[model samples]
Target: MAQFKPGERVEVSSNDRGFRGSWYAGTVVRREAKNTNRYVVEYDQLYEDGSGEKLLQETLDWIQLRPPPPPPEKKKVQFKFGDEVEAFYSDGWWEGAITGEHSGGKFAVFLQRL
Candidate 1:
């Protein structure tokens, strides 16, 4: 029997030597015990927003699979100088471009209005 079971989340190790250290998180859609290292996996598209997509489905070696890393802690967005963004203030949301970075994650922006 395969170590990984159906519906398990796993990380696929890169097969290319040039990207030897890269890994991608995916869900085990199906698992096969007919031979060693066999499973079907579904993952999120590169541009999709957190939605899972089945991009690959083939029996692969078990050595290419591993547990995925913990989900990253939610972090505040940090805007850099010259980045176009919206800023909230006492009035409301304002369209602007970041002028400078402050000590905190705050940024100074030149508002289009006011």
Candidate 2:
């Protein structure tokens, strides 16, 4: 049987009707056991068109789990003079070059180019 946890995103296999290759995206809300080898999953559908629907508690032997993307790498503060660095500004993080530095190694970076 497929193992699914609450709050996990899942893709429901296409319906037996003529539903084509489309799959429904939903969050697993409940699970029930039938007999000794089958599982019934209850899912809440989240649609792109701002509509939601609840499945009638379907049973399945397996479910696919899609992992979330990795987080971005953190920027290090160590930089030498004239080294390119991305500066956080009012607009957003902008690429810039370190123009000067203090005696304690604090850098004064200027936006060399957009």
Candidate 3:
């Protein structure tokens, strides 16, 4: 069984009839009092209503839980000024050109909306 500490974030595997193979984000609240292999987890987004007003908490076995994957590493792509690129705007990706370069692999992109 995997060991998880309290307050640690983890993903809980679904054991529901139709939701098998799904994993939900949650935090480990504590281990079960009588069962060392079980833990009490507070889900991040699992709710009891359609409005998501009530959060769901449950005791899950350690076998049904796993640590969340590590964050993705940032990659730097060199681009020259005036190089054409696609920038993600408020809601969607838009075509743009690199106007300037900044520290930490950041770039100033100018998107001209038609």
**Per-residue error (Å), model 3, residue 88:** 19
Candidate 2 C-alpha lDDT tens digits along 2-90: 56666666655433444323344455655554543334445444323434453555654454323233455697557778897656543
What is candidate 1's lDDT per residue for 13-104, written digit by digit as tens?
55664444445667787876586467777653332333544365545677878776566569866567899875654323345789988885
Q: In every candidate, how many clashes are there?
A: 0, 0, 0
The prediction achieving the highest lDDT against the true structure is 3
Highest TM-score model number: 3
TM-scores vs. true structure, each candidate:
0.48, 0.35, 0.61
Better-scoring candidate (lDDT), 1 or 2: 1
| Native-referenced Cα lDDT, model 3 | 0.79
Output the lDDT of residue 94, model 1. Answer: 44
Candidate with the larger lDDT of 1 and 3:
3
Ranking by TM-score: 3, 1, 2
Q: Quick one: how many clashes does candidate 2 have?
A: 0
